[model samples]
Target: MDEVITAADASITGSKSSIIPYNLPLLSAFLSCALAQFLKLFTTWYKEKRWESRRMLSSGGMPSSHSSTVTALAVAIGFQDGTGGSTFAIAVVLACVVMYDATGVRLHAGRQAELLNQIVCELPPEHPVSSVRPLRDSLGHTPLQVFAGAVLGCIVAYLMSSS
Candidate 1:
């Protein structure tokens, strides 16, 4: 009869574990972020009718990469560990904080940057501020963007977990 190796036994025996099994949650989160960023590029191309490679690296777009990453981590944790587990709880709280910051504080900060840039643009050309580069106007996501990212994260995590 074949012996069944439990997780604890396998660990104590120093058996090598596959990377995917050991790091599925982290992999899910990273993949979610990458997917969201890639989608941003397409979304921008679709709406603006111009391809912007910067969208692949920039923050604040149709879907929130930050939200997608954290939400995927949370959902992945919930799947691997029970939803009621402490790890899942921590993941959930972290996700909430990130999503809130993306949609609220960071969003407002981006707006403030836009206003500041506008003010700087109105200044005299000789002014020191006028010579400085404008603050990045797209630094955070809208609520709808965050929501879409959350949904995408959950879906990705669930699909990854099932496999």
Candidate 2:
């Protein structure tokens, strides 16, 4: 663990002793996303009263992984390049777009899928649509989830920068 951290520090300084190259922005983004997804396991268990290991790889959970990823990247870029740079501006725009889509279009689409699934289940067996598979209903996040993800991502970026 210490060695890995040393390597990361070395990488930032462009030191010859670095065991491997590491980019703080990329690392922050990935770690934030992974932590958000991993946290879904506990969140799901709290809400559903069951342990679901698959939540680590699933979407539409308490904290939005998509939001976490983008937010971390944006915050890290801002820290590295300064908020006034074109790179930081681009990153912030991208994060906003992604987070908005997650809560807006994707959330509504998931709700629609849930309604469609209910309708499909009620259809008569002879109906052509009765045999169709149900659409996935867990495809987006709530505003709270997005907010939590953003917070988590910001924390990750801060931690990475301090390291």
Best by TM-score: 2
Compared with the true structure, the alpha-carbon lDDT of candidate 2 equals 0.92
lDDT of 1 by residue, 55-163 (tens): 9999999889999999999999988888988899899999999999998889999999999999999999999889989999898888999999999899999999999
The sequence of per-residue lDDT tens digits that candidate 2 reaches over residues 114-135 is: 9999999999999999999899
For candidate 2, the C-alpha RMSD (Å) to the true structure equals 6.0
lDDT of each: 0.91, 0.92
Taking all chains together, the TM-score of candidate 1 against the true structure is 0.87
* Cα misplacement distance, residue 154 of candidate 1 (Å): 0.6
